[model samples]
Target: MKILHTSDWHLGRIFNQQSLLDDQAYILQEIIQQAVNHQVSAVIVAGDIYDRALPPADAVALLDRTLNTLIGEHNIPVIMISGNHDGAQRLGFGSSLLKHSGLHLFTSFDQLLEPVILSEAEGSDLVIWGIPYCDPEHVNQYYKVKTTDHQSAQEHVTQLLHEHIARHYPHSATHVVISHSFIAGASVSDSERSLSIGGAECVSADLFKDFHYTALGHLHQAQHRSYSHVRYSGSPLKYSFSEVNHNKGVSIVSFHADQSCNIEHVPLEPKRNVRIIEGELADLLAQGKKDPNNHDYVQVKLTNKEALLDPMASLREVYPNILDLVKVRNNEGSTNSERSRAQLARSEMDIINDFYHAMNNEHLTDEQRQILQNVLTELNNTDTERSSKRA
Candidate 1:
């Protein structure tokens, strides 16, 4: 059976306070097209369907339309769950109606026991065990946990799921587990929402040793965990500057009865690109002109002699998504000038003078100190003259 694994859609997400709905819509369209081209039996969205507990009206409309295209137009079954950023009750609405359309939405801990089972005439049955964003307290209440640690939470949930799976089907049936949590050895980007207060909430990949395949989510970078069978599909779009170079896409997995799987990455085409360019503004503009790539969302590291005035305004000339402009203040003639700028930024006038004096102190520069004194005296004279004129 063919199953395409994808997650962390983070619909309604914003980058640097700019709405990413357009990019997100484009990514989802790409996913649908890939599903059609591959003729996958099921499209599994591991979790994090939305960026917030209650998505906006536009986000809701977008999700609704996308699901229609997937289920109505493409005729593909979709199995999805809620993540830390989603509210279970909110996404769970109309889930009953959606199931009839071959879209299974597991949005709460109460439904973890119910695995969505699908089968084909060729005698292959695939069971998808959907575990939404598991909370220690909620899981304890649902499964009656004896402990609250990360391992205990996983053990409690997995044990219940195992018991159910074992009772329903034998080890012969193809099984896939879906979850939204951090796993050990998976790289996390800054844009992903944390599940707990500390990193201890993440479970080790060994917990899923029994499953044939695990489609995971929550991390924004596509990566394999401690187990090759366990993997994260990552987000569809670059949600942060840290993920400027990430190949945002989806994963397609083909399952066989022998418990072997083949995974492939399907590239996504986003509306805008996120890029980081490091050099002077002139050099960056020159490079952009020379290159064939589009400079949509860009972060420039300016290795310039001086800080540009209104760097954002200057970068907007070439790239619209100029989120950051890092100035590398340097020049052979302006070493002291750069230090002065740093000191002034910190409002440290005495420290600035002390540093200047110390730098020249060892050189026996009496002439330099006199020059500095004369400059300071002129500054004081100007202040006194301005104050008297104002009085």
Candidate 2:
């Protein structure tokens, strides 16, 4: 069976405060097209289907239409779950009705022990275990124990999952575990929230020892874990500047009765290209390489002494995605004394160097000279104290 693994679509996400509904619609259409072309049996959306629990009206409409296009038009089954950013009760609303339309949403841990089984006439079977984002309060209630950290929560859930698999599949059938959490060794993007601090929420890699394959989400970078069978499908689009260099895409996974799977990455087309360009304003204006024709989001760094007049307005005339601009101040100390003083104070060596520069190069008042001497004396005393302690 072929399954498309995609997550963190983050529908209704905004880029620099601009709505990404149009970009999301375009990517969603392409995803359906890929599903049809590849003849995939199922599409598994791991988590964070919406940017927020309460998505915007347009986001709601867009998701509704996209789901219809995939299931009704293409006749593919979809399995989705809610993440930390999603409200389980809200996403689970009308889920019973949507199931009749071939959409399976596992939004809460209340049904964590349940497995959604799909089988075909060829004697091949798939026992998919869907574990949604667990709220500590909910998991503690279900397990009858107070799970304080993510590690404990994961332990509780994994134990329950193993029991469920053993009870239902008899330890002989092929199974896949789908979950949304931060697994160890996975790269995190700025778009996602940290679920744990100091390894509190992290689970061991050996937790999925019984499963044929593990499909994960939460981290926006698609990658394989220590086990080849465990993988993350990552986010479908670049939601933040931290992910500007990542290739946004989906993974098409094919499963066989032999318990082997093949994974393929299908790229998504961006509505507007994201590019970072750095140079002096005069050079950028003269080069005229910031194509005005295409709608591309751009970050331009002005590597000049000062910023030009209305730099954004001028750049927007040539590049639509000039969402951010930064003026790179030259290294030469500013003529302004306050600016120089603040910069010099940032570094220990620079403080001493600035003092000496003032002493030898610039004329200074007796009061200013005495202040610099006092600062140097404090530094010398601190160094002497450290040396004495070491000795």
The candidate scoring highest on lDDT is 1
- Candidate 2 RMSD computed on C-alpha atoms after optimal superposition onto the true structure: 10.6
Candidate 2, residue 253: how far the Cα is off, in Å: 0.7
Candidate 2 least-lDDT 10 residues: 354-363
lDDT computed for candidate 2 = 0.78
Give the number of colliding residue pairs in candidate 1: 0
TM-scores, all candidates, are 0.84, 0.82
Which tens-of-lDDT digit does each residue in 116-219 have in candidate 1? 88787775688888988887877777766556666678778888888888787877688899988888667877897767776767788888978988999899
The lDDT values for all models are: 0.81, 0.78
Residue pairs with backbone overlap in model 1: none
